[model samples]
Target: MTTPLATSSSVFLQGLALSLGLIVAIGAQNAFVLRQGLRREHVGSVVLFCAMADALLISAGVLGMAQALGERPSLARFLALAGAAFLLLYGWQALWRARHSNQLEASAGGNGISRRSALAQAAAFTLLNPHVYLDTVLLVGSIGAQQAAALRGWFVAGASAASLCWFVALGFGARWLAPWFARPRAWQVLDGLIGVTMLVLSALLLRHALTGL
Candidate 1:
């Protein structure tokens, strides 16, 4: 028979592994976080906001919000379309930055963006993406709910821990790349890559939204 400690450890590890699998992907949110990290502007606030938002969503999912959301197809579609539109705009902005690559530079000091603006962008990136909902709410939540009642809390804790660790690493670890991004050409390439990724994600999301209609 499995001891309580063993069962708890198993559940927590499952949550950590699953969450990491879902989150450690190249998406608009990751791109934005990476950019902010490279820019060294309000990285703490951005990371904190993203991690906290994820934790809230994960907790909600475990608490049966997943079932509520699953019953609402219209809401999912709306979110997809909205996310696509937002991604398209952000993609355009990234592409514009790439085109004007001369202005791209790794700042050793502060970048001119305010904390409020940074937080706003972080919120938009976190909240606007339907994938975030699908992953945290539907996928993670459903799986978590399947666990023994006593262990659901442990699962959420593990998942929340993963988010916090990931955001902290990504937001702070990016400074190591500051040397490479010191060159304008590197920034140009990075922005161009981000632009293409955002646009492709937008297209896919838009297609998903329309197909469901």
Candidate 2:
């Protein structure tokens, strides 16, 4: 039975808490957002794009897109494998850029990083992540599906709001670390961290693929 409005409020709150808890964890997505934030170049667009992307992905999850994907493991594996390859490629590019473009931080280019480029990077990074489907689509969708039809919206709303909040916070909040990253040594640390993150995500996807086989 669908919960009353009052109960629905509490349920949604719980869902929001859980969703935020999961989304707040440091990942490649978070790293990219943080990097853009600290650089202070096009932060707003990056934040908005990421939040919107999350909303779309989460909506699809709740709307049964994942079920169709799950029905095709072979296809899923293909995406997973391709995603893993892309991650490895991106990891390399991120490292090269971090090393070379570390100088571009303070200098404000007239046309900084461009909206299309930022959105492309975010979408590529987000969609190519194999775990995103498992986490947002499968896990979140299942939770939403379990709730009564009326209450289900509450759960999804909580989750979607969480994603927006997380990306915005991550994108804007990283500015605090700007001074620290100004140091060349700090770039090494940041670059290394991003590199390690990409590698970890890649390994996880490969492991998942192998296990599924």
Candidate 3:
């Protein structure tokens, strides 16, 4: 018979692995976190905020919120549409920066934004993206809820750990890439890529929402 400890370990590892797989992709949230990290502005708070948000969402999922969401199609559609609009606006802003910014230095220009602005942007990036809900609440939560009651907490802990570690690494490790972003053209390229990515994601979300309707 499988021991309780062993089973709990298995569940924890599964949660960790699954969460990492889902969030390792370069999406709007990750891109925003990476940018903050590169700028080295309020990195600690941003990372903490993201990690806490993920933890709360994952916990909600494990508590059966996923089922409630699944039964509410209208709510889901609204979220997708709203998220798409947010992404569209942010993408345009990124493209504008790419077009107008010339002398982009690693420790310069971008730092002018206040801490409140940084946190606000972080909040928007985290909350406005529907994919975050799909991944953390729906996918992860559903999976976690399926676990035995005794193991559910362990699973959530594992998933939360993954989020915390990933954000910490991404937010703090971004400085290493400071050298590459030092050049004006490099900033332009990075901004352009972020813009294209956001736009593509927004378009996809919008299409999904419309088709489902």
lDDT per model vs. reference = 0.75, 0.66, 0.75
- Residue 36 error for model 1, in Å? 1.5
lDDT of 2 by residue, 1-213 (tens): 646889689657745754564464436777777777867867888888877877776777766844555467676666666656765775676566556535213322344578788878888778899878876776566545544567767878888888888777767877665455456666555565555556665676667666778
- Please count the clashing residue pairs in each candidate, in the order shown: 0, 0, 0
Query: Which 10-residue window in model 3 sums to the lowest lDDT?
Result: 103-112
- Give one digit per residue, the lDDT tens place, for model 1 in 1-213: 444998899789767756765675546787677778877889999999999999999998877843554667676567667756766786787778777644323334555689999899899999999989987876567556555568888999999999999888878977775455456677577677766766775686678778888
Off by over 4 Å in 1: 1-3, 65-111, 177-213
lDDT of 3 by residue, 1-213 (tens): 344888889888767866665565446677778778877788999999999999999998778743554667786677667756876886787788788655423333453577898889889998998988987887667556555567888999999998999899878987775454456677687667767766775686678778889
Name the candidate, 2 or 3, with the larger lDDT value. 3
Quote each prediction's TM-score. Answer: 0.62, 0.59, 0.62
